[model samples]
Target chain A: MVDDEADLAEAIGKALRREGYAVDVVHTASEALEITVYTPYDLISLDLTLPDGDGRTICRTIRAEHEHQPRILMLTARDDIEERVAGLDDGADDYLVKPFALPELFARVRTLLRRDADVAIGAELEIAGLRLDTAAHRVVWKEAEIDLTAKEFSLLRFFMTNADDVHSQEQLLEHVWDAAADPFTNTVRVTVGTLRRKLTAATGLQWIETVIGAGYRFVKEPVPG
Target chain B: MGRIRLPSFAETIRFRLSLAFAVVVFAVGAAAIAGVFLYENSTLVEPVIMAEKKIVRDLATGELTEVSVIFPEESQRVMAEKVELDAYRRALNSLRTSSFLALGILFLAAFGSGWFLSGWALKPVRSMTAVAQGITGSDLGRRIGMTGPRDEMRDMGDTFDSMLDRLEVAFDDQRRFVAEASHELRNPLAVARTNLELALQGGDDEEIRTAAAIAYDAATRMSGMVDELLDQARESLPVNASETVDLGDLARSVVQDFRASARQRGLRLEVRADPVEVTGDRLALRRAAVNLVSNAIRLAPEHSTVTVSVAKAEDGRAQLAVEDVGPGLTPDQRTRVFDRFWQGEGQEGRGAGLGLAIVKRIAERHGGTAEVVPAGDGSRFVITI
Candidate 1:
């Protein structure tokens, strides 16, 4: 992890280390660049603005130097979606905005790491009192197993995978259902409504948030009923 | 005791200009009146006075000896002419006073006309002053719509209005940024707080691990947000990094980075760039290019190809274009695509919809432009420097 904030770096380091990932922490951009240059880390949690240089630059330098570049998860105070997209463009595998829930961070890291199938093929996605097993395609919410249709499960996975970020119905349809734009389809909304009802019934936690004229925003940490 | 009315002499452009006009009028009017008075005195009065004296001298010796005191031809004539000369002298004195009076009237007229003309010519300037004075950070809508014959005063007003236009645009971008920043800042902090609390109130190791992992993510996000905010703070300054950046190399490097993600999404990110160099900030240019690519990737379909090309335009401007064959943008979307936080239908959660805005800013900073060039399949984002 590359961060200037001591307490935040320590806390995040401790949390990720518990997930069986060997993590290293750096306080300055220089140290980050130095460590990244030498060590082949699995992932680098970078702060965009650093004491020495910009995190985006560091991300670029890493991508330039390393043949097998480690996945980069950008952490920044920039909450703009364009900044996030730009971060990804700058070689960051994922991005999270400031003061975000640890659960959301976990989800992002897990998603990035999961991209490397060799390392994380069947890792479980855990959101307080809720767990998703990718290999078994099973969900246990509040210690109770809930039946889900394949489409519903796919939709839930997408929402869970990208927790705390809003996703439009079109985007949801594109990612979850591999079909191109069919302007007449309301399948995404119907599926989401069913998933929200089922999840709420079982876990007693409301997780899906609808943004008007936008799309659905999934809660990083489940909201208690 | 009465209230004292104090004069306010300010260095305002309007006051200075009006004073200048009044002074010029006074100088020209005074000179004209003085010339007329001097010419009239020399031509009409001086010769007449001299001839009258000569006649008096002639009468004093020869004609006076043979004169009858009763008839008194030479003496009476000389005396009457003397009274007439006195009258002429009084008339001359009156002319001199009248010239002074005319000068005094001219001074007042010059000053009044100068003040009136300056005010009339500077109506736009006064409006500009009001706008400049009344404008604050929040209110950027004031304008000096000067309409008149094309003159310097009108030009200044137009220039001032254009300047305000630029300012309003810049402020609009920053203002929207601040609003979005506030809303976004809360989410990550809330995320971190909740996860930390969950970790603190954990019952099982799995719960603690999940909570801690999430908390870590949030902290990372928060620090990154701070970084982004700092970057925006520094964005007001022009890009001072002057380097020989090879546009082709920059495009290639970006393409190489996104190669994996493109493949993962079953989309192709192709770079057809020629070796081109432009003097600019590398980081900024790279970001501009990256925003284009990222936007294309987001909007493009799974099987569609996203092309990022760098070449020289006909005008010798180094150009970068990112084209994607996806659901094409409508006229409305194209218009507002660069507006801050403008997420068109189904465009939310895409980095606050600021990709195009940043690209435009970066392009502008490089003394260039970013716009959409109509493409065959979908939309093409073009940045020319």
Candidate 2:
């Protein structure tokens, strides 16, 4: 989130973090740009007016520069049609006028994430014998429901979407974790290990395989009986 | 739409102008023709008929005698005089007829051309009327934009266009003021709502306390904004200008009011008075002075001096100025510093942002001007009436 109002930005960041989405907050366009250069965010809630620069220009520059496109949700005090149209035309994915409900913002964020994941809103993802409902945030191994933490759930969702493909620890860190995460940490491995153990305990099958000198990949199918 | 009802011919400017033109042309043409005729008549000399010498063969002397014979029945002088009078009468009659004919032609030509020329000349006025009638408060952007050589009609059009320009600007300012007011209110409202919502979410004691604190701050900001808005409205109201206000006294009172606050902030309040007086609202002028002094105290550096000066300028305008040893306004900021709700660079939520605007309003209400005087390393705000 980028807003000149530091208090509002902090409040929104705390709320999003409570919802299990890693969030980073900044107060100026320059700071936002400087940070986005290193860590690619999943979605950015940008305030239209900023002290250093316009949010639309920043959105446009992010779209032009980043290979991994981040969804831009513009937050503007102006509810006029022209402001919204200009923001969207300048590469904003959506806009929420100021003084909006927190619940509505959360819902829009969820929808944007689902869109980014290439899944329908509130749709259930089923691969082989594993089933996960994104809206309910539930996971079922075979017929047994498995409980998971927010991070584990996020990791599982990421692995399921890109099943059979290898993702390095850095890639997972960049995608699942926010810019605040330390790059040198083993949080990704630890979370992935925990997720694997949880899935194996439920179905008694090893669902994740680690290729030596490479990275982790989710098994697309259960082992043949 | 129904056609406009035309005024009577006599009531129309074109008709009156044409009639006036015809009258003038007739008068001048008749006088010129009559003068030439009179001059010709005055120069007409009666012809002299002299007695004729007749060589008559007398009955007795055949070829010797030549006699002057005058007829008794016909007087040669009278006959000559009658012929001359007849010729003069004919010439005068022709002259009179041609003169009248020429005068009539001149009057008709003058009236016709006058009617056409008047209509052509009034075309701009017609367009100006059309433009004026078509304009409304919401549609103030239309301008005559009349392009022509400088004339009375063009000057009127230009004046009208300039007036419209000013009106459009004022209207736009009003709209923007309302929008900014709403936006200002909404920002704090949003902050308060978010903070209260978070506080209600059953966070830890410290987190809840922080949320409540932020919410309280937002509420304070909203109240401040409301109060400032009220102050602005009050300042815009017509001041009771029946009383005389001494600027020196007003500045001293303002200085006294802000002295404690300045001392508390580790600042000095200095005063220079010259006993300048003006006829205006005393309360309004005091408010203006108080605003300037308070602003200077707020912005001036600690341990620096804020000088409140009241004097008559060189042109004999009564003036009150507050000079602060603070971060001076830049050229860009100077232009907009007096604008309503104009925030200083990165100084959001510091104040209600209407102080300068109110001061400006008060200054203008007294038929005066407010300005920021350039300083080497500080700022000075002056109100002169």
Candidate 3:
């Protein structure tokens, strides 16, 4: 768990522990990232607002380094519709707004944990001539390897995994960066743009399509032989 | 003079009724005074004049000498010009005094009657207002009873009660919708999550990857559903009265945010400036504009330009328009566009279908409106605020 509110973090950690899961609590996204480097976690409950940095950035960093990426559940007080959508789009497994009932919180954690059980822990994904190996953190398109920054790779992986769906910029921010990051910032756009350019240059194909006002859509339509 | 505060609902009812009562009492009092004056002039004073004339003739003809006059000289006259004049003056003086006293009594009676009558007439209304004020969102079912006749006040109360009934029903439906939608979304999300967890528990890499993908999809869909519910819930809230916002600047910022996406899609996104200003909730207005421009970009084909323009309309109304080069909506689609949850054929199941509806509601709340107009090979969504 990552949150600036010590009491809240402690309470959440206790609840998770009671649910039979080992819980590690941190007050800032930076600390959360530092801890995750040495100690692997199965699930991460993140608060978007933190004293040091945003949880979304930490989520991206973890997704980049870890072999089996832990599930993420974003906790935020801001209930704006766009913010929630942005959190989901960025790569968070789920999200809950503040003043949430504890039962609901526990339910969400259970749901995430149960879902993690169904997935093959370290499997690679391939679609539309693009390949992603989760264990290796490597991506290949049209038999050519693509090099991506930690943030870019996580973003591309999220896109390719959820192909043909529209994502809003707000969604991108939440799922791709620390929850504490400024939502109004256009970091997602700049990063996505850079990632798209790099992918196109490496694969020689236009895979990511802008859905206009909506967000972005990863079009996995195969090029004709 | 002391400052007078406007009366509360109860007080206002009492005051109005009292005023009406005072008018009626004044009219009746005036009629009574006129009747009294007429009787004194004709029946009493006129007959006395005739008798006095007969007595005066008898005294002149000497039929009786040294008559003992019970009345004073003025009163004994039989058309005695000087005496009649003096008698007339005395009678007029008495009449004037009596009339003045009667008027004073009538005014006092009228005021007392008005005060009591007003209180009596307004008792039910006061109670009804109190009952109405006690109602809250949770207890919208409570209503004032229509205990009186089918008069205007009763009609007004009945109308008010029925309005509350309608609101209660609407609120009930909304709450149910939110609950049902959330439940529906949760089930699928749970199933997907469970599957992903099982796959993760296994050591198979390919199965884990497939499970992860499915989980992500389910989660995304659930998020979308929740967002829709939230929008629906907020739609019914009263508009917030906040600081002024520059519509032009807001439009520009939203357009700029989407410019990169537009470029990536091989489309142009431009913001035209006219510096239209409006007073409203800046966040809401920005969201409205973002939804409009985003919708435009989605429909516009690659290489087509999407223009966002802000200016004052011909009617001195502030206007913000988002135009795009895409398949224009049919007349039917255009008509249904602003309707809640009404999506065009191709766009069905794509978005929450609440974007345009939200925009329309926001515009209406700001004493403005939104409409779709024909544009260059596409359509323009114009809002006046």
Q: Pick the candidate with the highest DockQ.
A: 2
Per-model DockQ: 0.12, 0.46, 0.02
Give the per-residue lDDT digits (tens) of candidate 3, residues B317-376.
Answer: 899999887788888778989976555544422455677988998888888999998786
- Give the 10-residue window scoring lowest on summed lDDT in candidate 1 chain A: A174-183
lDDT for each residue of candidate 1 in A176-225, tens digit (9 for 90 to 100): 65323364689888989999999999888888999999999988777766
Could you give me the TM-score of model 3 versus the true structure?
0.39
A1-225 per-residue lDDT for model 2 (tens digits) = 998887888898888777777788899999988888777777899998787788999999998987767889998787767789999999999999878888888888877776744333366667776888766778976677899999998888778766788988888897788877999988998999998888888887888988787889888775632
Identify the runs in model 2 with alpha carbons over 4 angstroms from their true place: A66-68, A123-136, A140-144, A160-165, A203-207, A218-225, B1-169, B238-242, B346-349
Q: What is the lDDT of residue A222 in candidate 3?
A: 36
lDDT of 3 by residue, A1-225 (tens): 887645446555544544434467788777888777755455688877564667677777777776657789988665557778888777889988654655577677656654532222345566756787554567877777788777787677567656677878876665455435677878888988998788778767777788877999877673432
Candidate 1: tens digits of C-alpha lDDT, residues B337-380: 89865555544233545567778888998889999866876989
What DockQ number belongs to candidate 2? 0.46
Query: How much of the true contact map at the interface does candidate 3 reproduce, as a fraction?
Result: 0.00
Question: How well does model 2 score by local distance difference test?
Answer: 0.83
Candidate 3 global lDDT: 0.71
Docking class of 1: incorrect
- lDDT of candidate 2 over B248-301, digit per residue (tens): 987887788787888898998999999998998888788788878877887777
Q: lDDT: which candidate is best?
A: 2
TM-score: model 2, chain A: 0.88
